[model samples]
Target: MTDTIRQRAEAALAEVEQVSAVVLAEPTDANAIVPLKDADKPVGAEITKRMAEIDMSDTQSIVSFGSNAQAELQEISQSMLQGVRNKDVGPAGDSLRGIVSTIRGFSVSELDVRRKRSWWETLLGKAAPFAQFTARFETVQNQIDKITEDLLSHEHTLLKDIKSLDILYDKTLNFYDELALYIAAGEEKLSILDETDIPAAEAEVEKAPEGDQVMKAQELRDLRAARDDLERRVHDLKLTRQVTMQSLPSIRLVQENDKSLVTKINSTLVNTVPLWETQLAQAVTIQRSAEAASAVRDANDLTNELLTANAKNLRESNKVIREEMERGVFDIEAVKQANADLIGTIEESLAIADEGKARRAAAEEELKKMEAELRDTLAAAKSRRDGVGDNAGTAVPGA
Candidate 1:
């Protein structure tokens, strides 16, 4: 039965790994390349209207993350200044003067187009959402850490209490042994003192001049002292034992509480687990809840990635459109003016694209939910199979 459970756990882990790999690979549908999705329609219309409203030239360029345009700008500025310096150094440098003038013209014009700013500037505009994500991640991590610390502390206290109880138990047993021995010795001493000596029986030992009488008196005194010491030790041991036994209830409670906390933390650390449990029988539920939440988060991340990737692809396509129209062979003004209409068309196309994306996303989410349900079903089936196998194996042969 244990082996069967181990096998199932390994299989589940393998499935989880496979799902993670799928996520990392960033799989996309060829269908996404042509957006026309139901969700895209309104977005496209909004985009078209937005483009129509804005002065086309005033639109900001979409800079990719971590681009190096700022450094390039600096280099261009320095080169232009160096050219001017060289031209001023010699009369034979008229060609250099012309080059310097041209370089300055290009640099100043490029600087005026703010679209060529650093990638950091673009990201700064979206700082609020980024910060929110960071805060949430931090909160989750801190909670996990706190639960872990609590579990460790509870376990430590329980262990310490248990050790104290064990020591106390040993002392109690030793004292009980000492008490039994003392009682036995006292009874013997009392017996000897109480027994009367016949005068004729003493007459024979009396020839030794009463030495026997003195020794007997001394023996009685020593036995009484020894008995007293043993009795006192036994009494102290009994008190210690009683105190230790009293602590047992509280100690057991502490142990139970620690075990409960450990179970809760283990379950809570997972995504599917519930937050509230009464220490016992609550851990499993919490574990399941945490798992479910994790599954949901995974699904959300996958969809978000796919959408973000599609957005990036659309932006790239727009750039390609711009570059193709700018080929030197065409009328520059006509090509430049065409950017306006192209923007509107792209917006409309994007709206169409967004709608299809929405539908696909909905389908993808449904599929994810079904996948989770399928896993549950598989787990249940495996459990049943193992149980049946165990019963069959345990049955008496030919009986």
Candidate 2:
């Protein structure tokens, strides 16, 4: 094993050895109390057995744990590539994409109820404004309902994902622990092969070429190869363990994001939605009251203005009748100017109509020519593509 891996394994084993036996409770019987050294005997023996069980020459998977494991965790690393998202992706990509989509779905609409309300509705004292507001309010309410429904749907998905992550979190931790133990055991086995097995194998190979010398050489080669393979296997397990460590934090970040989403959704539903509804109700009530008051004032103003307008109309009518009687039927100059204007207008209109017809005809011919050119271009392109495909599929004659 490499120095780095050896150090890590040694440190891990040292930590394990540091854990001493603990007394669960005070013993009532004097005989029940055992000395610390005696209590540690079983634990030390188990650790020894564990270290002895690591067979360096056996070429099975590292995480096999002598078949205590079903799946080997040495292949659990796509980490050399990266995490799901890179730094360039803005604000935690797919992790929060669902919540982001739901939140960003919120937008504004041009619900100009007043513009849609007719002038006559306001001036002629009708309930058209109230009807418009009520209908628009219903549409707004429906939009709110849609927002809630969409959020609820996203929440359901979040809940399911969170539960799945909880299970994954546990499995990942267990795998990491198992991989660490495997690495420590593999490291110790490598040490033994180097100090004892390799020296012995080399010594055996150094003997004279007699009495199965070829066999001894091959056995020495195999032993060294096995040790090298063990080192590489231990290295891979270390990488797998690192990846599992990264996964632990990744899982936690997702869980925290899920929690934040729940809080935001609850705030929208419980606080913001209810507050908007309350304000909308109050504004609608106030607007209705103002419209009713305005209608009463408009009625009184209309009555006063009508009484004054009748007197003014009589005075204007007398003056108009006198003025019309003094005027001539038609001035000669006015009639000539009227005829000239009418003729000029008709001539201009006719000229424009003719010019439009000629231009339209020219445009139609040009469009037909363009269409033909386009069709020819497309057909030629298709012919070239077909020729290329045919040539590509053709094979050369060979011996």
Candidate 3:
């Protein structure tokens, strides 16, 4: 009986060592569980079956914890996407109002309303000629304002998306940390089982049954108890190892997800945001040029109308002067002053027209520069995409 018991204890110890060796073997891949070799499969299956029979709560708890974490990660990912969609940087209406105010204040006189008004005009509470100016430029201002609002909206969307990406990155890193710690704890437990618990149990078995029949029988019972404890520890360690192996695929999945999201966010920041900004700036320049041209056109039309009215009045007055000369009466100074005023108005209108032409030319050049920048940015982005290839990195199994 003693010999048989010793043989059985030795067999159990050997089995424990075999399972420990299999469990502790280095994995072939970082992102996946190592596939068992033909020789290892039977032992691996046996360990898995025994673990299931024992119903190891620690192993189940770890799996359950990982499952809950994965589900939460999914929820966070969805929330991040929804948050990007739902987040508002600010109301376009407020920005639109500000743009309109800016347009209202934009002037050749550097927006100084006081410079356009004299002390006498202030004392008389006379409003500056802003009403007529706005009336003439309202259509162009409205178009510019609309474009400005659109640009602001795009900026807001980009900010929200970037914020969402940041949140997702943080959650992914936290999940990775937790998985690493769990894997480490499981590995440690397996190590303790192999190095300490199994060895101690084997020693106890070897030391048992060295006395008389009665004492030997008692020692044998203690040895059996020790063997049972060792068996349970081995089972628990096997289950922990299995759980850790199973978790690798999920960990890899999250890691890949994180990598993909980071790549996408970087692409948006590098390519999309800058492209939109360039387009917005170009639009603003075009609108400004149009506004300037419209102001010039309005000024020219007003100048022509005043000139025509003045010429008609002068002709009527000269006809009256000729009739008065026939009756011996005339005022030549008034005629001279009217001619001077007309020349000054024509010169001012021509100066405004020249300024508008210069502004339009500058705006056109700026637009061409913006277009070149956009093309360069797009080409660079495409080149980067191509260099990265279809798979950004090694394809992780089960990811």
Clashes of 2: 0
- Per-model C-alpha lDDT, please? 0.42, 0.58, 0.50
Ranking the candidates on lDDT from highest down gives: 2, 3, 1
Q: Once superposed on the true structure, which residue ranges of model 2 sit more than 4 Å away at CA?
A: 1-130, 207-211, 326-399
Location of the lowest summed lDDT over 10 successive residues in candidate 2: 18-27
Q: Mind giving the per-residue lDDT tens digits that candidate 1 earns over 1-399?
A: 123433433343443333224211111241121212232665444323322322212212111111121234335436545644653322212322332342233222222222344577566764332233344334544443444344334433433433443343334333333333332332333233335322323443445457686665554454445444434443543454355345445534543553444343233323221222122134334444655676688799999999999999999999999998878776779887899889999999999999999999999999989967665655555567666444543342321
- The residue pairs that clash in candidate 3, if any, are none
* lDDT score of residue 285 within candidate 3: 62
Q: Summarize candidate 2's per-residue lDDT along 1-399 as a digit string, tens digits.
A: 123433433443332222212112211233122222343565334335555655655656433443343143322333312433332323322323443353344222222223344676558765554565666676666666556555544544555555555555666666665555556666667777899998988888777467767888888887888778878877877777677677778877876676556555545554565666676678678767877877798799999999899889988998999999988899789999999999999999999999999999999999989967666655555567667434432332210
TM-score, candidate 1, is 0.26
Q: Which of candidates 1 and 2 reaches a greater TM-score? A: 2
Q: Judging by lDDT, tell me the better candidate of 2 and 3.
A: 2
Clashes of each: 24, 0, 0
- Candidate 3, 1-399: lDDT as tens digits: 123433433443443333224221223434232222321565445334323332222334433433333455678788866764775534433444554454455455522222457688679986554443444355544554354445434443444444444455555554544343333333444455467855665666666665555565555565445444545544554465466555545544544443444343333333444454455456456556666776788789999999999999999999998886775244678778999999999999999999999999999999989967665655555557675423532232221
What stretches of model 1 exceed 4 Å from their correct place?
Answer: 1-208, 270-399
Looking at candidate 3, the ten consecutive residues that score lowest on lDDT are 18-27
